[model samples]
Target: MIWNLGSINADNFYDLPHLPGPGETLTATRFRQGLGGKGANMSVAAARAGARVMHIGATGADGRWAAQRLFEYGVDIPHVAEVDSATGHANIHIDPQGENSIVIFAGANADIDEQMIGAALSEARPGDTLLLQNETSGQVYAAKTAKALGLRLIYAAAPFSAAAVAAILEDIDILVLNAVEAGQLHAATGRELDALPVGDVIVTLGSDGCKWISNTARTTRLFPAFPVVPVDTTGAGDTFTGYLASALDRSLPMPQAITLASRAGALMVTRRGTADVIPDLREVQDHDFG
Candidate 1:
């Protein structure tokens, strides 16, 4: 089982000729909406990847649909709460080149508290997996609680927060980061990425592929990116992390899990949108990585 403490967002997408410049107003060529949020994305991905996922989050009246959407995607959401604040949301502007610019509003996503976290975690047993991201509050409490309960913790350091990562570093078993965030974390801690004390540090290098530094073995391995043309790169990292977590939870070897995750992520970029586009296990299993 995977317990995800994360944000839920309504993703508003606008297709544009190019990203807007400073103070420039441009009309979108197309528009659509869907469920999103780094936390939400990971939970959906893990669920679709065949893990049982429990989502711990909050949504306002207007964002009730987001929670419902998560339920529809196979994530268990009994712990999701209805709060007073509006639901979180993101405005994603995509270009023909598949690049994007985004702005986020954190609403009920910031409403997570210890009560909600404690209650949700009470249902967990030892050795269950806990997934966390920076988009929501109570990460410190969640990390500590999960550790005390003997759950394995996988932390995806995105929208990276130095202080948050620093606060829970000792509790993390695996750390996931993309290239830029890895560099930022390196600068923040004044330590190389390989020097982190976590058992596994996975650095995603975009099209160049990802590298895994294993502290236990004192060795590193590389997994090359599968060949594919991207239409929109959104949610790829979340998909990778979610699938990776699910694979590990199933007792797959680390190298096999990373490779399977690479395939899922490569397929993710080939589609447009956010959580809606995360490929299910069957799709990934049937995909041609060539």
Candidate 2:
């Protein structure tokens, strides 16, 4: 199983022709609701990519229904918990340029505890992969426990929290980040990207593609994408991370895993919502890498 410990939320999206400037409010072109949250979106993405993904997250009364959404994408929910508090949610505003601003209510997400990790870890075994991003509490706890249990741990250093990155870097098996995040780590030390000590680091460069660096290996590559006029890009990053996890579970090498992941990321750009955008494996196989 590919275990994901993170947040779950129902996304409320407002579509506007353009982003609103400061002190300016524009009428929205459209709006809709979808199942999202980096955790949930990636959970679905991993599942769709053929990994048996189990999401460990907290939900509230009204938001309990949101957990069912993951089932639709074939993600396992044996670890999903529903508490008495209100569920967390995101109010997302997306412009035609595919950029977005999100206001989050971290209700149930902020309330996660170590007990949740303990419960989830009870069923895990060695060789399973535990994937984590910065969406919940107990990341270090999860990493340490997964390592102790002989499970491989993959970390996506996102949301750029300095304290959190410092807290969890040593325990990660593979460290993944974007260019800005890679710059953040490099700037703090005034060293080269490869100087940072980690098993592996992936710096995703959007259209320029992603670079993979390790102590023994370093290379950059691009994935094939369709000639897409992106409509929304809210979940592209999550898709990449999720697909990468799926590929890794299949024992694909780093290069092949990233190629598949990049294709998945590109496919996500052609859609409107995070949950609604993930493409299946067959679509990626037939996709032109031009």
Best by lDDT: 1
lDDT of 1: 0.93
Best by TM-score: 1
Candidate 1, residue 22: lDDT:
90
TM-score of each: 0.94, 0.89
| lDDT scores in order | 0.93, 0.82
Error of 1 at 119 (Å): 0.2
Q: Give a tens-digit lDDT track for model 1, residues 150-209.
A: 999999998999999899888999999999999899889999877887999999987888
Q: Any residue pairs clashing in model 1, and if so which?
A: none
Question: How many clashes show up per model?
Answer: 0, 1
Report the CA-based lDDT of candidate 2 relative to the real structure: 0.82
TM-score of 2: 0.89
